[model samples]
Target: MHHARSLTALLLTVLTLLAASACASTTPGTGSVPAASEDGAFPVTMTHRFGTTTIEARPQRVVTVGFNDQDFALAVGVEPVGVREFLGYPAPDRPWAPEGVRGKQLPTVGSQDLDLEAIAKLEPDLILGINSYIDDEAYGLLSGIAPTVAQTADYPEGATPWDKQTEQTGQALGRSEQATKIIAETRAAFDAAIAEHPEFEGKRAVFLLGSSAAGFYNLGADDYRTGWLTELGFDVDAKGGEISYEKLDTLDRDVLLGEGIAEADFKRDLVQQLTVVKEGRYVGLGAFDDDFAAALGFNSPLSLPFLLDIAVPRLAAATDGDPATTPAPYLG
Candidate 1:
């Protein structure tokens, strides 16, 4: 009886050890333990101009502090939890966001002002900001709440190339591959469109903002307005002088693109003084209404395709002089 009892006790001890071993093996950081695979989707660590940030998990809740940042987030297939409203722009109230993120529910976080309190309440995993919209002081505050990224270059804070900015933000979010694909796809679409209608070839074009208050604002090459136009095969004219809110009595170009200029304004005596106007070479782009300017305000990788769709057709028409006469498309 004693021998049998000893064997039983030993067997029970062995069973307990096995169970403990199994538990340890399943737990992380054990030598014999099975590791939980990241399933090829590991969180990324991103270092930007603002500071270092680690995204422990893919961000589902995001907040955009600037107009373009919001667009970039949407391009990567995620709508922001919060976004800034653009004043004096057509931001239509809708069931979802009005533009690129049209189907997603998003809250307005106020315009041109960073709503830290509102952002904190949303409990976002990530925040997107441009250098112009966010400063170092703001960055320190935002980083405490969530990982934030700022633009690489300095351009009036909110102005950066949509492609570069999108690429940077996507990398931070562990969606670099997705960003690359989006860019390539967009370029492909532009190529296809240009092939279908080749009237945008070798034509010099200028994008100007016409304001009753400020006469004209010619977009520089670095500006988003003319940058995209340059991409669409429009030769951007160079204005070497300092840019300011000034009226010009002369206009010279194969094509002239202006937003928010009334037909009556174009017909005014002031407009007739311009050489291009006298020659009938001016092609006023009435499409640059409130909605279009609002769209421009939020230029991002996601919105690039849409902008191309709108601007390219009109530009091609303006440059070629006729809808049917398709010129050779710009290859550069």
Candidate 2:
């Protein structure tokens, strides 16, 4: 299946809309033709929640307005001129993505506080906001400067599947073949890990992150934070709520996985005595523990391998069903 049937429909609809005279079915990520040449790839059009945007030619200067869209662009080798900063974390220079910006000075475009003036100054031909929260008004304003694309209706905001995001970015950049390769490689790594850890299946698990005075919170189904864990074949039980320290016992499961809770945070008697913890099956990481924390946010094709490299080993050690095996030596 070199081309996805659904993506083919999208390409056909767009091509028919523009009345493209003749072409066979397109490569899924590559638009209009099978492995379309840079010139043949456009006037390619992509439909999103904001509407259809037709790239008349291959984009020379693109800007990514979504917090996570830059990773998708970087995955496909399109170095965005400007990238929206996500959660105060530096982009391009991020630990999870070493080859993304590669020391090119990419200006920040403000994540939630999008600076339209800065974006317009960059003079981008294509604006990618596929993982963003650009409303109708903002989309119109961005479109005024250049063709602007917001998130598609198919995916919930901030929770687009990594593969789909990569595909659209590839189509937008006319680099679909490269995007397909990256996706296959990333999935293969996860698949290999799944094969190695058959014990992970038929088990219960929960993922929690960070803490507050009120309680520590777990992510919901739509949150990208838990997507990888779910894919690894665990019945990832996302509670979708916060639990106070006193009620931490309820998070008990075969394996407790999470990020941002320090080793000290688990020192409490209530946490230490939990069945999962006593069995040495908890793998929690500090916010600044390593690059895994930031990679969790990106969750793109480029960042997936970085996450798996660190996570799979730790999780495997924890879930080996042996109490003597310590998941992380630092996590007391």
Q: How accurate locally, in lDDT, is each candidate?
A: 0.58, 0.73
lDDT score, candidate 1, position 50: 62
Question: Global lDDT for candidate 2?
Answer: 0.73
- Candidate 1 lDDT over residue span 1-332, tens digit each: 01233333344443454444445532111111012222244467666666566677766667777655666665665556777665444444321233544454457665655655566666666777763356666666666667776666445444577777777766766666677877888778678767866767677676666645435667667666666676667777554223333356433666677776655655666666666555444555554444455555666554556656566665655565543543322211
Model 2 bad stretches (over 4 Å): 1-37, 96-100, 329-332
Model 1, global lDDT: 0.58
lDDT of 2 by residue, 1-332 (tens): 11233233344343343233223332222111222336667788899997899888877767898888888887777777778887666555666564534555678766666766566566677889888777776676667667877778997777788998898888888888889989998899889989998887766777778765556776656677888888887776544787888888877888887677755666767778989989989886547444677678888987888788778888888888788887773331
Q: Which candidate is the best by TM-score?
A: 2
**What TM-score goes with each of the models?**
0.72, 0.84
Candidate 1 lDDT score at position 46: 65
- Clashing residue pairs, candidate 1? 132-157, 198-327, 199-327
